[model samples]
Target: MTSADGKGPVVVKEGSDALLPCSLSTEENIEGKLFHWKKDGQKEVFLYDAGVHYNNGRPGQDEQFKGRVSHFQDGLKHRNASITIRNTKLADRGNYTCDFPRLQNQTFHIELDVGAAAEPSVTILDQIKDWALLQCLVRGASPMPKVEWKDSSGNMVPAHEPQVSQRGDGTYDVTLQAAVNKTDRFRCVVTQEEIYHQIYAETNVLLPPPPEND
Candidate 1:
């Protein structure tokens, strides 16, 4: 069993698909070698020899992995045994191991983090008697996050002045302002893609008077 090279941690979002790639450096024929992929510390999910089968030599696979996993025979010829996981879930977070019978085994660790779809937070930038400026900050995301504002009635509330800033840490900072009296319930929704997964984070911004004004 030969280990894969340059394998590192992979982050994925919820409800998405991801591929765990692995390759061997050996020149031996992989067809005769028994192949197995399992979630480390979990049950074997996939195995193959001259044909695809499970650990028990059954014709079918574990129901939990039905329609969610697959591998390529040609890929294995090149010492590649990458597996695809469709509709990734938060529960799928963990290390995965690929082993070859009478050979070496390779391990790949995966970390999956689920982002919140609704996170409501507020930061008062400035406040006046009739008007105020507030900042709604949404953090920890991949790809690009979409931020939208909504009023209490669930109506789309256009930002009086919309401003967006990218943080050094790869997250986003979105700021929007509204009239103090017009404030009711403003919701901030953040959406992004982590790896091949879709994740989101959101926060609600409320406009209340400062302690001095209260």
Candidate 2:
């Protein structure tokens, strides 16, 4: 799909194949055209043109990207020279450019983050003797994220003590406090709609009671 803005870098998950969309405003016959894909400072990793794969005919692709690279068929229709990299690896993280032979040059840069998916944690702590403190934590998220608290009924519970704070490491920590009740089920929802495409992670926690000995 087209990017939200006309220009910028796109971020994708590691280990998963990503499609970088590129559209040209110029009208030209891209059929039987030569398409080349390569990293910014690297040689051509894959090439296709004249309805055939040229990388195999030429010097061949790099040993690292032997069978992991392919051109997007539909991309040629709208002047989209996107490439699909299968089984993406951490080393594949870098900028990419698509060169159209005898047509035009287009560059699309991407950043791939390879690591474990974010893990969300919910903690219930008692504060002010009667208020229940619900904390939601997510690690390794860029651009921050939106946090919300909801009850079992799927209704948004009003929270007066909700705070969003940034950790020293640049991660995010959200805290929402509400009156504690034995029957209330509080859920901490962490969403990064833009990057993750949905709620990255969430957790449900129950408020515990004070110690009887106290």
Candidate 3:
């Protein structure tokens, strides 16, 4: 593949679609040609032979990618063979190859990096006389998010060091706890800067009033 398109990994947020680009460097139309796309050089992501495709009931697509991969049919005449993966998952992150086995065995490579899944749930764990203990937890997120607690006014609230663990599926689970001295609407903000994605969940903490004076 030509270096005209600088080599950089395609960044996509988890659960969103990702476009892996590939095309004929010679700008030769490939509408009636055959090309193959594979993941990590193993999984059959998609394949197009002549006018038929794996998505068009051609079959033979890897089970993990079935019904989730698509190609740009209109771009075929422009030498484009790019494919898009819908509802991306962390397991889908890997190196991909676009191959034209018939034409001098021409091949191109692309890297895909699926970002973290955003969705942190906040809940009240415990409440004392004047303070309430709140917990925020994020599960099944990749590349571990920067979890934090903030008040309704957006000021950061002090919290215990986040407890992080990895799941069997290679995703992460993070838990953070904070003690708020006053009743307020608190939020747990989850940020994955690499993908420029941020999400948050909030909860209201209402501490009972102090005991009445004698």
Task: Give the best candidate by TM-score.
Answer: 3
Q: Please, what are the lDDT tens digits per residue for candidate 3 over residues 103-145? A: 9999888888897766899889988789999999999887788
Name the candidate that leads on lDDT: 3
Question: 202 in model 1: Cα distance from truth in Å?
Answer: 11
Q: Which residue segments of model 3 deviate by more than 4 Å?
A: 1-4, 56-59, 208-214
Provide the lDDT at 10 for model 2.
59
In order of listing, the candidates' clash counts read: 7, 0, 0
lDDT on C-alpha atoms for all candidate structures: 0.57, 0.58, 0.88
Give residue 210's error in model 3 in angstroms: 8.0
For candidate 3, what is the lDDT? 0.88
Model 2 misplaced regions, further than 4 Å = 1-15, 22-33, 41-45, 49-66, 73-80, 87-94, 101-117, 127-129, 157-182, 200-214
lDDT of 2 by residue, 45-135 (tens): 6777766774446666777777777666765776655667777664665566666656745544444333223456667655455356666
**Which has the better lDDT: candidate 1, or candidate 3?**
3
**Lowest summed lDDT window (length 10), candidate 1:** 111-120
Order of quality (lDDT): 3, 2, 1
